[model samples]
Target: MTRADYVMPSNSELEAATPPLWSIEEQRPRISAVDLFCGVGGLTHGLVQGGIRVGAGVDIDPACRYPFESNNSATFIEKDVNELSGADLLQHFAPGDLKLLAGCAPCQPFSTYSRSGRSKKRGLDWQLVLGFGQLVQELKPELVTMENVPQLADHAVFQDFLGHLDGYHVWHSVVECSAIGVPQSRRRLVLLASKLGSDGLRLDTGDYGKRTVRETISELPPIMAGEQHAGDPLHTSSTLSPLNMRRIKASRPGGTWRDWEPELRAACHRKESGASYPSVYGRMEWDAIAPTITTQCFGYGNGRFGHPEQDRAISLREAAMLQTFPADYKFVRSGEKIQFSRLGRLIGNAVPVRLGEVIAKTLTSHVKMIFG
Candidate 1:
């Protein structure tokens, strides 16, 4: 996104500003927000539940437009973030006096797994983060928020983003997402900032006790490999080879391929070096939080993604639920067959909606504390 020219609003201007809490409660002239890099509206849904009046979501993926619109009742624009301007967002707001802008920028660049060849591929995505900083510099919204993998907080790109907050009060932390009620183990770096000075701002952790894998998926109707739950098309599972059938059936929950008999071992696993990754070809523990659900979470061979005892890989819907999306969330149109590649990317890449809710509450409480 090209940077828009802007001047910092002075202290008198800041003091003259009305706290948005009034608009939220009176239900007229509501506080409005915009979400960038929104994927399938997971964070948007949670933000709505947290009480922000979201107006538009910007994402480059056309596939995101449907769910982002359907669930959040917000406009979804298909454009790269680098192409966006502060003016592009102004059109979406209602008659709100205060505005908030937020997003979870694409996180692959900072993910632990993607760290392998970071130097060459970092340009495009790295620019996206810089673009976000540029927008903040221009729009200077009353509030700013974002969710990304934890490693990002360590990078120079993030530090430069921090430098852009010249007069803003910022609260940031690396959070254990499971502790906040997401059913998978995800660690994310969350940043919340406000133009108001840092006096009373804080981000509180949720005390809602742990959510386990069984609590999430034990109730869904069972389906076999390559079969769709007759009632829910999204619950379809991928087919397993005859060899994989035996592999999964022999697999115990939370156990690795190390449990397999010598005859059943894949040639790769039999190699001495392959012993390093014990999580692959394993089943999830029924009573534990699931392993992090990745872009390839639906494929059993990719990780410990096998169904606990079903002798099949976890289905698409299961992966979505594990990511804290509601059971009824739709990724594709009705009567459309589920495409694992596209849909998996949507689910795996989404911010667990619960995480959004936490950010929402944090922002709400902070606003109330400072405004009142």
Candidate 2:
């Protein structure tokens, strides 16, 4: 496919197409939410698709503004989570609608604190998750939900977060993204708290089955290492070093450094320290799901990001697709140069759109049970 075959819309075009939140006609007893730490509208998009209304998205990054607004039709507020209050979120909800406050707080600080044995006195970064709880307490939003790394379930802060839900019935579980149609082996801690009643919310078993890498992206035209597809700039791959190119060529699907000839293997892999780290610098299996897409997933040496049959790592667009973003989803505006770092971070950090849709579906069912 060529660029002409798929023209990304202009910023103005997307804005004009997006209906203002305030102008949307009210449905009686409807559910609307404001997404906190909403990176590039993944959850918002899924919520919209699941038949919920999203009024706005709040995040600290200015770069998130365009994609969050343009794709989701929700107002994107560029502000830190700590700076926000219930009033800031309350303004976004339609009068009489069930207010749902949803967020995915950053978990990096927890990892940092865990390493230092300072889990109790966590820094400002750890406070962001608590800030979500703060908003919940102040707004008393009828429904609340949060998503994060599954490992967070073991943290003291996670327990602290639960303490804020005194009057709410809550349920949380680790959700496998592939079960929800995301073509990646991603698992997330999904939590739901409701003020409505005793019967707690639960996610329905997904029907999608495990989607595979080939199924998700095989239709796209091929591009070599460091080459861009003429039809899709986002389909561009990073250039591999000559040695790395040789390494990738020697690598096999689902295979590790063991698959490579000794000369093609990295020096680190030659050491005992690397013996336990076989998952890195490997190619994805065409029939299997992809590894967790990380911020550096565009790089050939990062995780199992190499393409199954192609001699280069997967492209930025492929990574987004594995994250369940639509082929036409716009991360950058038309003619804006696509930076691998910026786009990769935005896509990787986002809650998979499919998982968000699953959350929305669960919440919508709960709303119906209460109101109807």
Candidate 3:
């Protein structure tokens, strides 16, 4: 026979021809899930740790592929989700097997920062959520979950999307991350939907008093200004210019540029034009949780990014830890130098692993109640 004629079947075809790979009768039922827009695979990592098998992750950013694959042991497909079809998804997951779809699409269009001053431009970014909705309608996964900035709940398109999932019992709430033991004051809208249950889905909130900044990052080895921690790839700090070093030296923990002497203040800070922006040049307090981390977290001028006690901005590793990624999560390849911009985006965009763990645990409990 020709080699072409004898070619082996792909994994999907073999899976379909064979009996169910995992049988609930013979073993503990494992909930299978797919993560869309899976940034850095934080949710995927947590889901796997929670006993849910993550089949694959889909994202448009190529930068996310390495960390996603490296950290989660899941396949990462770099493609715009709008171009994907139901057949593509069915290849990984068998029909009639318990299916779950989880996603937290880019929220820039609905973000509070983006709304500050700009005319609304509708385009592919706006269509992302609709694309996600279409996939849900086609695949009809038994359960669905999503997380995003609470501002998204105010959008009309988001409201319509919720209405379309009429057959599924859905529960949504604007959850405070601090209230969920995340150690930050960030608030996000979380939604859970189930087609199999009439009681709807709700995540249990644990006692919120356990986690704090001191408890989370206080124990790590300290690095000085413009220094990276030894043997820690993500613990690299940004270099400060001489003038900025003076400013940083004068900066008090939890204070802003207003604390500086008149001669040391930035010109814009003294001008009426910059009166409205108060968070710039601010430092975090060691005793309290840090401010909301953003994509520009490595830059000193970006929000309240100054280090609490150090004279430099918080390092990339600190940012990741604040996002609830484990201390040793591999952000870059071994022997490769870490790039701040690449690492910053990966850290900022990730769903905090701890938060994902909480969500996955709750969903798994729900699934076990029904099918286990």
Of the candidates shown, which would achieve the greatest lDDT relative to the real structure?
A: 2
Clashes (candidate 1):
1
Task: Estimate the Cα RMSD of every predicted model relative to the unseen true structure.
Answer: 5.5, 8.8, 6.7
**Per-model TM-score versus the true fold:** 0.90, 0.89, 0.87
Candidate 2 off by > 4 Å: 1-28, 110-122, 198-200
Which 10 successive residues of model 3 have the least lDDT summed?
Answer: 1-10
Would you list the clashing residue pairs of candidate 3?
none
Please report, as a residue range, the 10-residue window in candidate 2 with the lowest summed lDDT. 19-28
> What is the number of backbone collisions in each predicted candidate, taken in the order shown?
1, 2, 0
Best by TM-score: 1
lDDT of 3: 0.77
Q: Write the per-residue lDDT of candidate 1 for residues 1-372, one digit (tens) a residue.
A: 001222334455445544442343433223568898999988888888887778899999999988788777788899998888888788776543457788988877777666766776687788888888888888878788878888889889999888877788898898888898888888888898887546545556758778999999989999999999878999998999999889898899999898989898888888998788899889999999999999888899989899986889999999999988899987878888789988889999998988888777777766555555
- Model 2: what TM-score? 0.89
* Candidate rank order under TM-score: 1, 2, 3
Better of 2 and 3 by TM-score: 2
Against the reference, the lDDT scores of all candidates come to 0.82, 0.84, 0.77
The digit string of per-residue lDDT tens for model 3 on 278-318 reads 77878877778878877778888777888887788888988
Score candidate 2 by lDDT. 0.84
